[model samples]
Target: MAMTPKELLNQLMQTEGAMCAALVDYNSGMLLESVGSGMDLELAAAGNTEVVRAKMKTMKSLGMQGTIEDILITLTHQYHIIRPVEKHDGLFIYYVLDRSRANLAMARRKVLEAESQTAI
Candidate 1:
């Protein structure tokens, strides 16, 4: 059976240091689904949308040819990962992790697996 959006996010949260996870629509800055707490996911989704748009615009201006696989924003205490869903345009997965408890490499791999397994 195909995993639902919530199920996929729940899987991401099972990662050692996951703080929050969400599926977002970059074009409209909408949160399609989310899990975990503390942070304002709606605000994060909207803000990240601008981040994605800016990066894409910069890439276009620089004449870059390839699509963005992921964008990592490392904070003092957290690691924010933004991965565009290959099968869905203008949609992406956003996950926040506790730096001290999360394995970045493993989290990245998990994200890839989740993306592949996700249908929308």
Candidate 2:
């Protein structure tokens, strides 16, 4: 079934080791919706917005011609994922997972599934 933005996030959180998830507007650096705890998703949304913007700018500067499917940030204890929503311009998904317990490949697959099912 089709899922609302929040429902999609909830589904994402069901992934093993999932910590938090949010739907963000990259254009405005705003958190449209979020779930879970530990990290401050509001601030994360704003910061990651810049991350997306900088990458986009760099891509243009290099004259690269392809869309960003997703951005991955690996930390000592966590894995962060940023995925741009296909149908919604300037919108994206942010998901965090614990490195030890999560299966990176499976988590990535689930995020892609959630991205596909999400309605922005």
Candidate 3:
């Protein structure tokens, strides 16, 4: 069975040191569902939409021939991940982790797992 949006977000939050997780609509740059909160997830998710668009635009201009797997933004004290959902078009997963406690490799794998199970 496929996971619901809320279940997907919850699964994301289970990652060690996870701060926030949200299902973002790529076209509208809006959060469809979210869980956990130390920061403003809605704002961050929307901004990451711009990041995805810029990368897509660059890819098109350069004639690149691959889909974006994930975008990682490392901050001074935080790690942000933007993962485009492969099962559905026009959707992405926005996940935040604490740099001091989260394992990047595991987080990446977890996001991929969550993406695979996400239903909407």
Candidate 2, residue 15: the lDDT equals 91
**CA lDDT of every candidate:** 0.96, 0.94, 0.91
Q: What is the lDDT of residue 62 in candidate 2?
A: 100
Query: Model 1: per-residue lDDT, tens digit, 1-120?
Result: 567889999999999999999999999999999999869999999999999999999999999999999999999999999999999999999999999999999999999999889876
The 10-residue segment with the lowest total lDDT in model 2: 111-120
Residue 52, candidate 1: alpha-carbon lDDT: 96
Each candidate's TM vs. the true structure?
0.98, 0.98, 0.97
- Runs with alpha carbons beyond 4 Å of true place in candidate 1: none
**Using alpha carbons, what is the TM-score of model 2?**
0.98
Candidate 1 Cα lDDT to native: 0.96
Per-residue lDDT of 4-119 in model 3, one digit per residue for the tens?
99998898888899999988988999989999989888888789999999999999999999999999999999999999999888899989999999999999999998889777
Clashing pairs in 2: none
Candidate 3 pairs with clashing backbones = none
Q: Which ranges of candidate 2 are over 4 A from the true structure? A: none
Off by over 4 Å in 3: none
> Worst 10-residue stretch by lDDT in candidate 3?
111-120
As a whole number from 0 to 100, the lDDT of residue 111 in candidate 2 is 87
How far out, in Å, is residue 82 in model 2? 0.4
